[model samples]
Target: GVASVAISKCCQVSDVFTELCIASRTKSKCDALAAKLAPTTRTKITTAQVDADDVQQLCDLINSYKPDLVMNIALPY
Candidate 1:
């Protein structure tokens, strides 16, 4: 939660985060976070449903998004 908030704040303040895709196993959470920050920040936010435990899924998402950077903030527990 804190990681998402911190990253979203950075997106809001800095131009470095021009485009952001918030993906999580629970797509609703990602959508909610994006909706909350979309109005305030210029960062283009998108949400996708992804189960991080699945290597194929993660890889496919990475390939599909083609982002310059990726942040894995979800705890491994």
Candidate 2:
């Protein structure tokens, strides 16, 4: 799961990613994913309702979160 991935990354880099923002059209799904990831990982995960197809919205979220990197895992369709 996401927590495992974060843990793996932390092990590799010797630094835990503290803040993460999950942007998805469905807030519930994002929330669920974050919840699942929270217990096992050291990162602070957050969710935002956003339409990936909307460039402006994505931009806004990116600006608000200001993540070190944006991981685009949205569906193609």
Candidate 3:
């Protein structure tokens, strides 16, 4: 379930760039992944509820987190 491209991009960036995954659907799932990635990787992962379809919600999350990049992992259904 790892995002290879995201991980690769993170690796290419500075080692300190924190990695955050938007778990809009399930917090537990995000927490589990964060736990797995925390020990081995230089990046740190956090979760937030961000429904990409909802622009306002997404914007709110962006403003709150102030991340350099936002990766969309949700299905485009």
**lDDT for each of the candidates?**
0.86, 0.70, 0.64
Candidate 3 deviant stretches above 4 angstroms: 2-16
lDDT for each residue of candidate 1 in 6-76, tens digit (9 for 90 to 100): 66776876578888888889999888888888778888888999999999999999999999989898787
RMSD of 2: 3.7
Between prediction 1 and prediction 3, which has the larger lDDT? 1
Any residue pairs clashing in model 3, and if so which? Answer: none
Clash count, one per candidate: 0, 0, 0
After superposition, the stretches of candidate 2 with alpha carbons farther than 4 Å from their true spots are 1-14
Best by lDDT: 1
lDDT of 2 by residue, 1-77 (tens): 46435434643442456677776777897788778767766777778899878899989988888878776653456
Which candidate model has the greater TM-score, 2 or 3? 2
Q: Which residue segments of model 1 deviate by more than 4 Å?
A: none
Alpha carbon deviation, residue 2, candidate 2 (Å)? 9.8
Evaluated at residue 30, the lDDT of candidate 3 is: 61
In TM-score terms, candidate 1 sits at 0.90
Better of 1 and 3 by TM-score: 1
Residues 1-77, candidate 3: write the lDDT tens digits. Answer: 45544654664553567565545656676666667666666766677655567889878888888877766654568
